[model samples]
Target: MEVATSNPAEETNVWGGGTRPLNASYGKLMMWFFIVSDALTFSGFLVSYGFSRFKNIDSWPIADEVFTHFPFLHGIDAPMYYVALMTFILIFSSVTMVLAVDAGHHMQKGKVTFYMFLTIIGGAVFVGSQAWEWKNFIKGEYGALETKGGQILQFVDQTTGKRVALADIATPIATDRETHLGSNGVWYVSETELPSVSVAEVKAGFEANENVVIRIQKLDENGHKTVLSRAESLEKINAATTVVEGANLIHNEYGNRLFADFFFFITGFHGFHVFSGVIINLIIFFNIIVGTYEKRGHYEMVEKVGLYWHFVDLVWVFVFTFFYLV
Candidate 1:
């Protein structure tokens, strides 16, 4: 008989076979590396957003005012409600992922499939809800006037102290307006579709309505926009150069243009991640359905993807806090 001895190697050696580095398999370890790098990227975005917001804290659009739309309840001021539901859906999906991973550990194919299916449904709903939110944000509710200096001035009824939509206040003008089209003008440049309300129409309506007042983009100590007086409103309205109906890369009726820019960039970036996660989940799901993992003697693949799904959910927590709560 011959005595056998085990070779000693540091756990930190990723290629070492004696011990698993960080007590994780190769796939899980790689997933963690990816998560850490992605987390740093999101941290940079948040830090930059914080600095920009601090510089213009007073003038920043209130989250409540900006995210007031709900799924089917039009004209209802249900602020932070829809987004709360979206957050819950993500969190719930994360829970289902945990269950699926546990089921995989037990080699319960049926349970794993069920939980994975639920997770996929949750992810689909979340992505769809995000699309709806973006649509509403871009379309916007009320329109505003853009000055030559690019300042936004919204309309508010002085008596009610509530913001009014351009549709409700704009008087129809009788004039044949020629739209600026790319083919008609310079071939290299093109203009967007015209706004619903015209500058002339807005001016005419404001002049005729005694209750309407000008709300400048600048916010007062109370965090509300600075409402110009009857005399000041007339002077401010005189400087209007264009009619900006909604948000774009250049203009935003909801205060700072940078706010909208950050909103689109960061949220769009996160949405892309969610979309990718959903696609990945679907592939893994199909693999599991086809007994690919069952024949492998283990379900490590499910565990690996669960880690990624959890990371996506965790990132959204920070995003929700910064974009909505804070």
Candidate 2:
């Protein structure tokens, strides 16, 4: 006697008569849920960022003025252009990903391979651009002076309209000498290059540079930096440059530490997300080339991944608006 077996293909037959529900495979459902949770996590970060920005509304540095660097545009005030370009690249990659999914629907292997390759290229370029941005930020421009209270103070020259470094203005009051170095006394450890300009150096630079002036933390109702006219600034300094002091969270030579901190954290987190998405996409792309999905006779995997790629692009849209735009 032969035993009857249920057919996998027969599961969808109605009127046998119970119809099988068109259930999404486990992988696709899990991906959807993961994307939703991850989106909430990002939302929490952005909401916190918004709160901080609101709390410090009056003193926050204008985002446009702060991040204006663009590739191949030396010294041009091309604010938002570079980041906009990065956004376009990611969005275009999402488009290609969708097209790849469409081709996979028709079982077009060659087209899928081509589009996936393009997506990978776009992701690589975006990651490289982000690295360049980080380098520029970490190196910093026009540099700020850190106060005893850890605030930042920035210097500007009225004539040059450029940021002035503290080192350019002030000479440090050298301390007592000859408390020399030795393994026992205070062994020298491997040292890293200092990241910021010291406040004393900023003061000396201010005195040395004829065009330089100080911008104090306190501003009038109009939101301008408390400035001294060139002559008055020099006169006040000569009388007593002791007005110079350290920075705090409330005040800093660079502008606001919170601004810097928020910038580093938010963009850094977004960059990390982009990095992970690229890795996942690459894995899928390789699988396509190796015939894994085609052998299964279903391209739903490509569609699912396309959804994720689009979601990444969507997150970047908000990030650009908040971080680089208004």
For candidate 1, write residues 45-80 as lDDT tens digits: 988999899998888888998899998899999999
lDDT (0-100) at residue 152 of candidate 2? 42
Worst 10 residues of 1 by lDDT: 1-10
Q: What would you estimate as the lDDT of candidate 2?
A: 0.70
**Candidate 1: stretches off by over 4 Å:** 1-17
Model 2 CA deviation exceeding 4 Å by range: 1-23, 167-191, 195-198, 217-253
> For each candidate, what TM-score against the reference?
0.94, 0.78
Per-model CA lDDT versus the true structure = 0.89, 0.70
Please give, for residues 161-226, the per-residue lDDT of candidate 2 as tens digits: 666655566666654433233543646643232323343544566766778875554455886656
Q: Which candidate is the best by lDDT?
A: 1
